[model samples]
Target: MKGIIFSEFLNLVEDTFGLEICQKMLDENQSDGVYTSVGTYDHRDLVKLIVTLSQLTGVDAEELQRVYGKSIFIRLYQSMPGLQGQAHSTFEFVKSVEEYIHIEVKKLYQNANPPKFTFVSEKKAQLIMDYHSARCMSHVCFGLLQGCADHFNEQMDIDMQPLDDDGTEVRFTLNII
Candidate 1:
């Protein structure tokens, strides 16, 4: 996983659960909790932090992942200038995840294992995406969609379809309602 992910996750933990819990998590967990945006580490480290936060806050791991995904999107949006203005709507933004954002990510980090999103369909008010990622972070993707809705000040109706037992493949149908 990318270092920015860990850093942002730590920041999210600190922001959501106060610095004390964040510190305690770092103090007790295997991770050193010192992540640099440009470094890379084991995905387990990230999972460890998430699991710790979930235990501390009594939130389900999946729910925390979703919220973390949403929080990460805010950081992503703030870091990448004009990303919000480029998309006229949340559907367009979600559709652009693989085509645009991942492309740019590859330009910066060729080895980065970002998720693959295939455009499935689109209608007047809905868009469908087929997602595949070994990371099994579909809930995070869900949160990103939710965050996009918030970014555009729009509401979204989203349906999740899991295609495998591991949840590596998921279909997300987003409605701008």
Candidate 2:
């Protein structure tokens, strides 16, 4: 995981909850609470933060991750100016993740271990995204898809299923509405 993700997650917590709660979370967490956008940290730290927040808020980790992902997309849109003015539809943008966004990310951080995403199907009304990651952040991916739809003001019907029972490999089907 990257420090920017931790910073963003904390930011979302603070904005949705309060600074007091956010500060308390950081204090309770084993992490030192110092995060630099370009810095990388253990993925377990992020999982801990989310789990703690879930315990505090009585929100499931999956739901929290989904919301976090959806909101984070807004920040991504603002930070990546190259994507802001582009006219690609939401589905188009989602389809470009592995080829465009992840490629750029790897260029900046050669050691970054990004998830592998393959667009199994690209059609006028539907898309099939195959997500494979050791980190197992499919809930976040769902949120990202929702955020993309929201960003483009497009209504989408999305269905997610794990290829295996463990959920390490998942498939996402997006049908534009």
Candidate 3:
């Protein structure tokens, strides 16, 4: 996983749960909680942090991932000047995730293992995307989708369907509300 993710997650934890909890979670984890945006780390580190945060906060792990996704979206959008004005709508932005955003990510981090998103269908008010990632963190994708809708000031309804037992594949249907 990317270190920016860990950094942002820790920031979110600190913002939401206070510094003490964030520090405590970090102390419990194997990592030292120091992450550089350009560095790469084990995906398990993030999983461990999420698990620890959930236990400390009494929140579901998936829910925390979703919230983190939403929280990070704005930072990502603002930081990526190249893609800033390229997308004006939620559908437009979501469509660009695989081709544009991930491509930019690959340019920045050659070893980054970003997830794959395939559009199953496209419509004026809806989109169906097939998500595949070995890490199987679709809830984060769902949160990003919601964050996109929120960013565009558009209302949306999203549905997720699991295609495998391991959550490596998921189908997401998003419709403008």
What is the full ranking by TM-score, best candidate first?
3, 2, 1
- Mark the regions of model 3 whose C-alpha exceeds 4 Å error after superposition: none
TM-score of structure candidate 1: 0.93
Which model is ahead, 1 or 3, in terms of lDDT? 3
> Among all windows of ten consecutive residues in candidate 2, which has the lowest summed lDDT?
79-88
Q: After superposition, how far is residue 94 of candidate 2 from its true place, in Å?
A: 1.2
Candidate 3, residues 57-150: lDDT per residue as tens digits?
9999999999999889998888788888899999988878888889988988888789999899998888999999999889988898888899
Tens-digit lDDT string for candidate 2 (51-120): 8888888999999999999989888777777766564688778756776788988888998988888889
Clashes of each: 0, 0, 0
Compare the candidates by TM-score and give the number of the best one: 3
TM-score result, candidate 3? 0.96
TM-scores of the models, in the order given:
0.93, 0.94, 0.96
Between prediction 2 and prediction 3, the one with superior lDDT is 3
Global lDDT of model 2: 0.86
Candidate 3 backbone collisions, by pair? none
